[model samples]
Target: MERQRMSTSEELMHLPWWMVLLEGIAALIIGVLLLTSPGMTTLVLTQVLGFYWLIVGVLALVNLFVDHSLWGWKLCSGILGILAGLVIIRHPLWSTLFIPALVVLVLAVQSLIQGGIKIFEAFRGGGFGAVILGILNILLGVVLLSAPLMAAFVLPLVVGIFALIGGVAAIFGAFRLHNSALRASIQQTPT
Candidate 1:
């Protein structure tokens, strides 16, 4: 029996296109703002980072009590996120300069782990796309980590680039979905 291919919708359900585009657009906007106001960028970045960390931490904390299986990991992540959030709040200036570097470090570590898992999963009959995505993620993380200080200066630009790519991907996916739906409806009509 031939393995069934996943439809565009099915793939996109797990990776929504509009959300990707929105995220990209938001980053692009932020990048533009940062470029126009370099002096204020640090404060803006700090506030954004702090809020983000705080929200994620709160969500993780909630998850810890809501799910028993992931209690340990959730709780740990929650605590760490909260602590990081507080630090950012307390030292916005420092956070603005250092948060990007921290992000790069964390992403680099996470990408390696995620890529390894993807490679292993692919070996065990997962999709080739997963492996490819994993490799790309790892490469991106490595690039971020290689020159974190320099990357920090260009963080907004990097984020904008990522977002733009993601947005384009989302738009393409959306069009694919539109075409598929059109085709399916036409096929279902009486000849």
Candidate 2:
């Protein structure tokens, strides 16, 4: 018998419904915590991120042995990730302050570049939608640059609200998926 290959979508569909439910539950908890206590939640989440980076760095280095490909990239990334994680973990308060501001600055630069591209595209007949989007992106970039600290401070609240909404959506979707899977299983079973 020849083996069949499963595409990404098919592979995803094969994941157990309960796994999605567990993910939903975790998201819901994190969302509630984020909303109720943004400051503390952000701090804890940052630490978690640091730990995650550390683990990923170690894993990347280990994977170099399993696969000889891209050793240089892996080695550089692993070292950078480990150093960054250690710095963040060792200086939690400083990390908490610096990371958001860094993110804002990076976003501002990205937005400005994206806006320029969009505007250029519009000039090349991309349409009115592109013009509007380009203008909006430029405006956003300016705003982020002008008050990066303020934006950084508000970032947690914004993220919290988004998380809360996404968590609810995920939970509902999980239930729907679970029911659909159940129905499909019943339909396939012999009576």
Candidate 3:
């Protein structure tokens, strides 16, 4: 007999339900922390980022010895990463302000790019919805770019709100997955 192939979602749903439940719980806790103590929590996470960048930078430079194909790019990235890591680590308070603002700027740039793509698609016959979306994206991008530092201050609260919603949804999805699996198992079992 040929084995049946599972759909992507079916395969994903087969993940142990307990794992999803645990993830939900963790996300919920993080959301609460972020909302309650946005500054402290963000600071702690930024510290972790500092450590990660430092390690990755060191590794990149060391990797140069093993692979010399892109020496220039690797060297440049390694040095930049190292400097960024060191600066962030040395000045925690500054990093908390600078990092978020930098990220907002990047997001603004991304929004602009995406908006341009949407408009291009609209011209190629994607309809008015795409054009409207494109316009909104451009507007938002401009707004963000105009006040990245101000947006940075609100970033944590926004993230916290998203986390809380995601956590709650994940918790519900986990239970649904568990029930679905239980029903599937029951159907498969021989009497």
**Candidate with the greatest lDDT versus the true structure:** 3
Q: Cα miss at 46, model 2 (Å)?
A: 0.9
What is every candidate's alpha-carbon RMSD to the true fold? Answer: 7.0, 3.9, 3.7
Give one digit per residue, the lDDT tens place, for model 2 in 135-176. 999999999999999998888878777777777777777777
Q: 1-191, model 1: which lDDT tens digit per residue? A: 13344575466545544565565566556656666665476578788779889899999999877887878888998999899998888888887777777777787788878888888888888889889977887787788678778767776666655655665666566666666767767999999
Whole-model Cα lDDT of every candidate shown, in order: 0.74, 0.84, 0.89
Preferred candidate (TM-score higher): 1 or 2: 2
Cα displacement (Å) at residue 93, model 3: 1.0
Q: What is the Å distance of residue 118 in model 2 from its true position? A: 1.4
lDDT of 1 at 22: 64
Q: Rank the candidates by lDDT, best first.
A: 3, 2, 1
Top-TM-score candidate index = 2
Q: Local error of candidate 1 at 118, Å?
A: 17
Candidate 3: regions farther than 4 A off? 1-6, 58-82
